[model samples]
Target: MPLRLPPLPALRFFEAAGRHQSFKLAAAELNVTPSAISHGIVGLEQALGVELFAREPRGISLTASGADYLSYVSEAFSLIAIGTQRLPNHRADRPIALSCAPTFASRWLLPRLAGFRARWPNVNVSVDTSHRQVGFPVDGFDFAVRMSRAPVAGTAWTRLFGERFVPVCSPAYLANLRDEQGNADLRRATLIHVNAASEDWQAWFDATGTEGIDTAAGLRVDTIQLAFEAAAMGLGVALGRRPLVDRDIDNGTLVQACAATIASTTAYWLVSAENADRRPELFDFKRWLVSEAEHFDTHANPADQALQSTAN
Candidate 1:
């Protein structure tokens, strides 16, 4: 009825030491000082009422009792990792849970989701829009679509798409820029930025080779949709993704300020842990997802920037 478990710090210390066979090595792995690891192991040994290791001149070695205990500890940890990874997809029989950025969800995935439902009629789906970097086994999500220049550590990464962003604004904002120079106009206008990627403005500047741009002069939001909405409402100009704002550009809701476009270092990444991918349901969900991604790509051109003159 009661959960009887050793203190987490002690167990963690023991697990690290056992795996590495050295307090020093474990300490390095865990980002703690060697003295801290030694102290933690000492505490763990007292709690367990047994000697876990033999200190040698060269390094540490596990005692017989320690070796036996380690096997159980290792297995327990493996199971814990498995359980944690499964939690997000725990409702596998129900809705397939997917985590993504709010703007990416709203502008891209949300509109395209109906096709997934229609195709995979038996498989239910749920979407969570968040910018937090959630650990695979800890967050209880089946898979996540993250915006990153490269693969995130400790996860399998699938490249979804490379986004090309161009400066977009409401017609009213462009009217203000009517008299300003090409590069100077953008600098004069209120610039809208997404906070999630700090290098976004810099990368755009580098790609466009547009010098003398000040990134500090504008409003920053975490989600791209918010930035787009702000730009659409005549709040400011935003670097807008072509795929996400295709409909808006078509309908003349947003206008491109310059003919120049830059490729974003941030890309849509489909990610899941190795253990999580082992589940059959996860494979099923992934297969369906790949299909949906292909479908969206078919209609959306990766290249093709329509100017305001043509859009209107």
Candidate 2:
């Protein structure tokens, strides 16, 4: 008996669409047109006799069935990828596949990636950024860097460093917040929030024993990068997560909004499968990563040092 299954292309479309919930993004990732992605998924729905997505004016969302189907489909693809990677003829020089958090990837890792390339000229790194905690070899990633409060229960995991959250904004904006005594007055300031629902502002407030300022009133953005950008434009104060915000603060794109600093509950970690020993490149990459983190300088900017000194 022949097994019933959607076309390979259709399945690929469905998987990508389900993961991103955006036909345009899925199409871009697959190097195809958005219409092609939409049509392929439509053909897939017709084959399966089930609606996989609810199309909305702003965007699309996976249906309950689609969500369930996505799990199995994703797992099947992961297995296939793992098998392909294990093939004897697999190239020795395949790029390192790394899964990392989106914000960290864009703000911290991408900036330092050049340094890594400089050290290991022959080695290549392919980064896939997501907030998802993807599995080890099953997900076809050689390794991953994730943010967490505790170590992963069972994996080759190591702590990188903790982050300090400080409010930051453009220097011109900071000048306005300075009071007669040179201390910041946040009561009249606008807050730039990463997410409306997140406790970023509230946590900072609690840590600093701050009150009287309205944390609920703020410009909300989906990503930390956007938050920093908004703050840089003198729009409002952003809860700047250090390491991620270091470069911006260093370059004078942003300034310390206030002297108060709060340590983050979560820190970045490097996680890999125990069997990663099979890849010598993984070892070298990990060593390079550890060294980079160990020596990361957060206080190099002269202007920034002067500002912090005054604020203190």
Candidate whose TM-score is highest:
2
Runs in model 1 with CA error above 4 Å?
1-4, 7-78, 81-92, 180-184, 275-281, 305-312
Record all residue pairs in model 1 with backbone atoms less than 3 Å apart, i.e. clashing. Answer: 88-140, 88-141
The deviation in Å at residue 47 for candidate 1 is 8.2
* C-alpha lDDT of candidate 1 relative to the true structure: 0.75
Q: lDDT by residue for model 2 over 74-162, one digit each (tens)?
A: 87887777677778858778888889867788877888899889888999999997555455565567888877788867578878777
Q: Mark the regions of model 2 whose C-alpha exceeds 4 Å error after superposition.
A: 1-4, 21-24, 50-65, 99-107, 110-119, 127-141, 148-158, 195-199, 218-223, 229-233, 247-253, 271-276, 294-312
lDDT of 1 by residue, 1-312 (tens): 998887788777787788777787677666899899989888888988999999989889999999998877766776686775557755447566788877678877877768767766787777887434444453356689977889967678887776777888988788888763433287678889888764566677787678887878899887777888898999988887868877778788899877777666777788975664577656867876667677666655434534422332
Name the best candidate (by lDDT).
Answer: 2
lDDT of 2 at 100: 82
Error of 1 at 168 (Å): 0.6
